[model samples]
Target: MAAAAAPKSNAPHIPVLLRPLIAAVAPVQGVWLDGTLGAGGYARALLDAGADQVIGVDRDPLAHDMAQGWGAEYGDRLRLVLGNFAQMDDYATDLDGVVLDLGVSSMQLDLAERGFSFMKDGPLDMRMSQEGPSAADLVNTAEESDLADILYLYGEERASRRIARAIVKARTEAPIETTLHLAGLIERCLPRSKPGQAHAATRSFQAIRIAVNDEYGALIAGLEAAERALKEGGQLAVVTFHSIEDRIVKRFLTARSGGGGTGSRHAPEITREEPQFTLKSRKAIGPDDEELAVNPRARSARLRVATRTDAPAGQSERSALGVPMLKGAK
Candidate 1:
């Protein structure tokens, strides 16, 4: 089903690495996929860069609506799907190239009602798809130990136990329903510190959001699906924000590109399966100073690209990409 319409707002979503991302993906007059069509930014860029057609997938209905608006302008050049990129294989048939711009979008974060940001005073709802259980449910209902584990594992928060204990104690007296309340509680749990690094509640909020949305799970499935969907010689470009996400991309690309240490020459030439992809760039691409200056969010972003190789004869095409191994596969 088509996504509902987005509310009219003038806030501009600056696309990160517009030139480099377009150049790396190289969508040239063929079917291209924007796996995380956050603001329709990359899809619009792909169309402008001479792509014949683009398929945009987003879990957020708002993103699909934004794409629909762009579709009206582009006229048959775009298709917006109300689904997650993890299902790309189900939706994108005979894809030429795919770009997965991972992480939360500025649009969602900026909207107070979306509850993606602690800075905003809204309900504790961080689900990207808007259909899943809200962050409030997780925080209010989960056991203190489970909550602590979520914060520690996903947020990397060192004081997860203290924070979770505080949350459970607070919720017993009153449900932690608002973003600001939770943010305040987390802040209280943390020791006061210098400014500018990040908010005290940042990690805890991130952990909750990740847990509510199962973001890491979706990411692993999405990357595997994108790899399976691409045609031989087709490229895959991924932009990740957090270390957890970036590490997954790094390992996936490394495994497919055969970057694991090869054994010594003395050992018999161990011929594992042929590499599935050749590295497009030697190292991960970060946003340039210019892009970073304009968009502070670009600071944490990392881009990696690879080109698919021809499958061995008589082997299933899907097998060419190798087993879909993720760091924290669900």
Candidate 2:
């Protein structure tokens, strides 16, 4: 395999926390899998860092298309798979390492046609795989209460009911068809944003996108898949963008590392068994000043790393992971 090349000025997007992530999992080698191979930043880095082979998996066809150009440089050493990371175990097992960078890819957000950005005006579609129900479908058809649940639970939007009511009202006049249309509607429903604060529509858009993609559900499933796929001593490094994601990763690691105890003071004590993984650190790695200077988008990114144990992989209770669920969702 070829050595990893220096980052190009025209690179699709900067890989957040790349330096810290590499350092945390130093001496990167053997066969590894990159679960969220968006722009192939991590994949390229791993390959360059001495991984003999890297399987890049993503559900978005855009990722696969983009991979064709740069991936050719690595030839057979870099393999691309068009599927969600939740099914990573089926792709390969006994892996040396697995890297999952959660959240929408920068490539997807930069493309207006992909409808991930509020800054860009385009369709209301937020499908990572570019299939299934889109943001537009949910915005126009979902019941007001359900939309409210998504906004409050997924995006942590405080004015969820207000926004949901507005959406229901606006869609009745005509379908909420485009990105800007929905963004504008949401902005109208909220108070004006203060300088340096996120846009008024930010939380609502994030919630809608999460609902449209089943991101949280897939995240838990992917973590479990990583647990099952890695061999003893295999490493798992996950980078999460928001608090909710970071919390889930932290809890999953805690539970698997044998720190998880009873649900509450009133709850029954749970039995323990051989743990499946060992935590590399109880703390998550965040971007340093240099990284923040280079890429402000990485400000919220958090990386957690753990090593697989010889114990057999087991399923985790989703409820314990702090996965926000809509009412009645299983």
Question: Whose TM-score is greatest here?
Answer: 2
The residue pairs found clashing in candidate 2 are: none
In the range 108-132, model 2's lDDT, one tens digit per residue, is 8878888898989998988988888
Q: What are the candidates' C-alpha RMSDs?
A: 3.9, 4.0
Model 1 residue 278 lDDT score: 83
Residue 327 displacement in candidate 1 (angstroms): 14
Q: Candidate 1 lDDT, tens digit per residue, 14-131?
A: 7777678887876466889998888888888889888888898888988866765666888888888878888898997667888988878888888788888989899888888888
| TM-scores of the models, in the order given | 0.89, 0.95
Going through the candidates in order, what is the number of backbone clashes in each?
0, 0
Q: State each model's CA lDDT, in order.
A: 0.81, 0.90
lDDT for predicted candidate 2 compared with the true structure: 0.90
Q: What TM value does model 2 have?
A: 0.95
